[model samples]
Structures are given as structure tokens and as C-alpha cells.
Target: MTVSGKTRHRFRCRYTSMPSPTSSLSSSYRNPGGSVSSSSLYHHASYLRRGKLVLGIMDFKWTLVFVITLLNLQPSSANGNGTVERKVHVGFIVDTQSWMGKIVDSCISMALSDLYLRNNHYRTKLVVHTRDFHGDPFLVLSQALSLLQSVELDALIVAESSGGVKILAGLGSRVKIPIISLFAAAPSLSFSQHPYWIRIGEDESSQAKGIATIVEEFRWRSVIFIYEDNDSAREFLPDLITSFEETDTRIALHIALLTSSTDGDIIDQLKKLMDLHTSVYVVHTSPILASRLFLNAKWLGMIGKEYAWITTSMITNFVNSMDPSVIEAMQGVVRFKPYVPSSKAVRRFEIRWSKNIDGNQNLQEIELNVCMVYGPMI
Candidate 1:
């Protein structure tokens, strides 16, 4: 029994807070024959060992024969017995050229269908809407809105960089549906005008709070924030610096306004910072920039127990994915924003998606973060 198509009403789950994708499943049933109580099964779903998804099996009985058949079938969206198709539509409007943009897009594309199918018990026809914020974001967003306004979408998931907030602001009153915003750092999001808009990514304020936590936890006496000269950086850094200042934290601020600077100059300025004996040096930039600094630190033999370096979570995962040698030097030295998945649900989703998607079994570092905010499978 799979529910297909968008219901006029959102099915607000009885249990709706964020769940650990890796949490242990607490219950299961043992019905010998075909029939089982739908009430019990629906309320307490059976998941695989480590919260991995059990694909194609909604709240229903599966005989041993059918189970084996499903297990043997090549995993994909279509295919497998006991699977009911439910198409979900989602749209992401964001800049695709940047590293973060590319990552967000890839994460959503790879994980959405498989995750939604397993978690929500429905197959999804994911429709992503994207736009680059390079030129006039207003124009790009307006175009996106025009396309989406008429489409009979299940749900609209919009993603935008910092610059795309105005677009979100403009669309707040015009579009009348559940809108989930990704990577949105709009000042207005805190208010009621955009009630439908829910932000899931680590905003600058959250990033700052995370930094302040690390600073206080480690008892790093003093800190210096090194940032690029850009509107986003400038806007966020001051608040971050202010948050750390509450403890009367010793802070030094340095600006690297590089419209076009050679790698040597970049490294040279970092080398000078290395000479400062700052307890912890923070870089509020993208992964590319963070990696450069990490590499420079490694080259200068500046990475060690003596100097603790930290940055926002945006760069931490990328740092971990770098070359082993590069990773080794900075291992345990960097930390990213932390959000644990429902261990029980995650294990269930993995198993389910694995069978559905034909055994593409590697699940480490896959992004289901979008799934967290935009509950729609698509």
C-alpha cells in the first residue's frame, strides 16, 4: 500500500523532529501468514540493522519468495517486486558554477529519490530547478518562478547562494506553497513573512556559533580571522568576530583583499600569519580557499599540535577528501558543522536504496541533508 501523488495536505508526522539516519531500529514484527495489523506496522516501521532503508517494502507483508526476488533484482528506481511508484517533484534555484553550488546540486540529485523512497515509502520523479546567480539574480529567479508557478509540483525546494535571498524575499508573497530554502542566509528569514521558507544549511550565524564553541572548548587564548574581501565574507565575519567577543575573547582581524594575487603572495601572507603565534587561525571561505591554506600550512611545516586551526563546516568535509598526505597533516585539525542522521532510518534507507538502485552500495559522505529540510522525496 503506497500512497502516490501529492496529497492536498502535508502529512505531518506524529514524530517529526530530526532523526538520526543511523539510529538503531527499536521494533519489528513476526507475522507468519500474509495478513498483519496495518496500525502497528504503519506506526512502527521495520528498518534494516543500522537504520538502512528497506526498499520497495511499504507497510505490508512480504513472503520469503518475494523478498528473495527483490533482493536479487538490480537496484534502481524502477524494478523490484513489492515496489509502488510515487513520483515527487522538487526544484532548486541556485548558482551551479561555484564549488558549493556544484556540491549541493550533486548531493540532492544522488540521494533524494533513493532516500525518499525508503523513508517515506514512495518512489519520486525528482524535478530540480536551478539558476546561476552570476548576472542579475532577480532575473534568473524571476524566470525560475515563472516556470514553477504553473507547474503542478508536489513541493518546491529552492536553493540559492547568499545573493539569492532577495529572490527568496520577492517570491515569499507571490508563491503559495510549502517552499524549503537551501543555503539561505537571508536576514528576513527570521521573520514571519517567509514562514513557508525553512533554512537547513549552516548559515553564517550558526557557523560563527560553531567556531565560538571550538574556541572556548579548546581554551585557545587568542584567535585571528582571515577572510577574503567579498560581500558575503565581509557581511558574516563581523558578526562571527562579535560572537567570540562576548567572552571578551582575544581577537585579531586581518583582511586579504585579493582581486588577483599569485599563489605565492597568498602563501606569503599566510606565512606571515603563521609567524604571529595565534592560537587558532580561522578562514571563512569556501573549500578551495580552505584547502589552499591547509596546503600552505603543510608546506611551511606549520601544521602541528602547537597551532590549532579551524574553519566552518563547509570546508571541513572537502578538507577530509583531499590527498592523503594533505589529509594526514591536517587530520583531526579541522572540524565541520555536525548533524547526525537517524542511525536506524539511515540503515533502512541504505538497504532499501541499495536494492532499488541496483547495488550502488557505497554510502559514505552521501548528502541526505536536503532530505532533512525538504521532506519531499523528489
Candidate 2:
């Protein structure tokens, strides 16, 4: 399922071969039009027997030249600042299972295809992987490393949810290439040991600090933290609670331990918190769990005036497919502000990107920002 090595490895695997169109034409040229040309038919039979279409050195060289030329036509580059030109064959290791991964992958693809690469300048390829960690971060890290090893790349783009980040941080030293984390929340990955790793999304520490600011602004005396008791919550909840200590906030931790996170479990948790006089109720959970909370809250008629719920930015995808009334009702009540994009610049790029991709504007702002920034630089 995965391609390995610079050269194609021959195996005892079933495969088919086809003759070159040029050779087929050449043999036909030597004979008059008939039921079949003898030379052409012989070459075709030979190709089928070989079970592989092997291109000559000249074709390989031409392909390399074309790819190089395509990679060179970027809108921005290190050379723009009069710096020495250092080209890169960037590889993106994306998780196709997650919503954010798909967004980042599409953006990278659109940026490469529509940017200078299409014009024959900068060379880039996106290597899509899957997030099948099942709450284990190590699985994600291993998959990324394995896929990365298969590609010839100068940089790697890793897009993962929480569990994925843990795996990547653990495997930080082993991954020699520059790895940029896209839409990740793990803060530990930003440590000095992994200098090549850059956080493309808001780090957990930054997000926790941001929430602390909100808590202070509202002058909430007592805070209640409810998390979907999973590995991510286990890893982050303590750090998040501790982050509030810097602001002199007292946090009452509430755990809704769910094996499968059913609607009943969510409502049951809300019932317990309903009587608590906490002003801010911080939800340390996924958007799937967030949607459950919102739905249960709405059904119980406690969404509007009772308690204000705050969660992570993961709810953006869930918000899109939510009930319109639920979405509107949860706006101020359940808020998670993302990094604000400058409207003017974003609009301009949206128009241009839409035109290039040949469709309507349908990309996340962060992903679009990556495209805008790197499109010119690649």
C-alpha cells in the first residue's frame, strides 16, 4: 500500500505491463494499414510478457527536469530577501481520518497545484496517512515516521488531533526532517529539543493561557471543569487547571467518565453541574463530545441562562453540521474563539484560491493562511 525507496522494487507480485505509445506508433509506421502491424504487435506482446513499463534514462531525466522547473515558480522564496537559494522537496504527512487533516491537506495540495508548481517552478507532494491511534499518540507518531521514510522530502507536515500530537512529541528526536504540526494542541512538542518542529495551530499552553484571560475578564470566582474522560483529557486537564492557578482562579474538577460517550452520560453530567454556582464551565473534550453537551443542554432547556460553557476550537467542524437553532443558541453560551484572520487579506486570497482550485471557497482560515504564506514562499 506504500511506496518505498527511490527505485521501484520488483517483487513476486501480480502486475500488468503496457507498451510505450511511441514504440507502438514506430512499429505501425514501418507497416501499411492492416488488421494488425507485425512489428507493433510483436512489441505489444513483449511488453505484456514483461509485466512492467520501464521508462528509459532520458524519460526519467525529463521528468526530473519538469518537476524541478515546476517547483521553481513560487510566489515567494528565501531568495526574495536576497538570501542564498535553498530549494526543498517538502513532504506532508496528513491524517485523512480527521476533519482538520483533510483541510490542511487540501490547502497544501491547492497551494502546490495552483501556485508555482503548476507553472513548473516549486516541487511538492502531500503524503496522506490516517489517524488510527485509538487514543494512543504513539500510533500516530509511528505512522507519520513510516510514511515520511517512504518519501524524499526536506520538510514534513503533520496534521493530527490530540492523540496524534502525543505520538509525534514522543518520536520528536527520531524524525530528522523539519516537522510542522498542523492543527495540533500538544504544547510539549514546542520544546527546544525539537527545534525543527513548529506549531502551526494554537498550542495547548497558549490555549490554556487564553482561557485563563477569559476567566479573569469575567471575574469568575469559582470555575467548573468537565472533561470527556479520555486520554487527551487525562493528559491536558491537569495542565489546563494548573494554568488557571496563575490567575488565582479556583477550579472544581468534574469528571464524566464515559466508555462510549452516549447522550445520557452527557446529560447526567450536566445535571450534576446545574446546581453548582460556577460562572464558567470549561469543557475539556472533543467536538463530538461538545455536540453531545450542546444537544443535551438544549434538550434539558439549560443552554441559555443557566451556565456559560467554553471548550476548545475543535468544535468548528461540529458546528457546521449542527442543528441551526442549536448552533445559534450555543454561540455566546458555548464560545471558542479561533485566531482571528484579517478580513481584507483573507477575502482577496479566498477569491484567488477559489479561482485556482476551480470551485467555491471551502477551506479553513488557518489552512488558507498556510497557503497564502507558503504559496508565495515555495
Candidate achieving the largest lDDT: 2
- TM-scores of the candidates are 0.60, 0.62
After superposition, the stretches of candidate 1 with alpha carbons farther than 4 Å from their true spots are 1-90, 95-155, 175-178, 193-196, 228-232, 256-261, 275-277, 348-378
Error of 2 at 169 (Å): 3.9
Candidate 1, after superposition: displacement of residue 48 in Å? 34
Per-residue CA lDDT of model 1 for 1-378, tens digit only, reads 111112111111111112234431122112223222324333332211111111111111222233234323422355467565544444556565654455455556556555555567434334555555543455556756765775644445565545556556556556654455555355445547665555544445544654554455345667887766655566677667766875545677565636355668778887778678674677666655666666777778666545556555555535434555655555435444434335786666555444443532223333333223222222
- For each candidate, what is the lDDT? 0.49, 0.50
| Residue 160 displacement in candidate 2 (angstroms) | 1.2
Locate the minimum summed-lDDT window of 10 residues in model 2: 9-18
User: RMSD in angstroms, all models?
Assistant: 16.5, 25.3
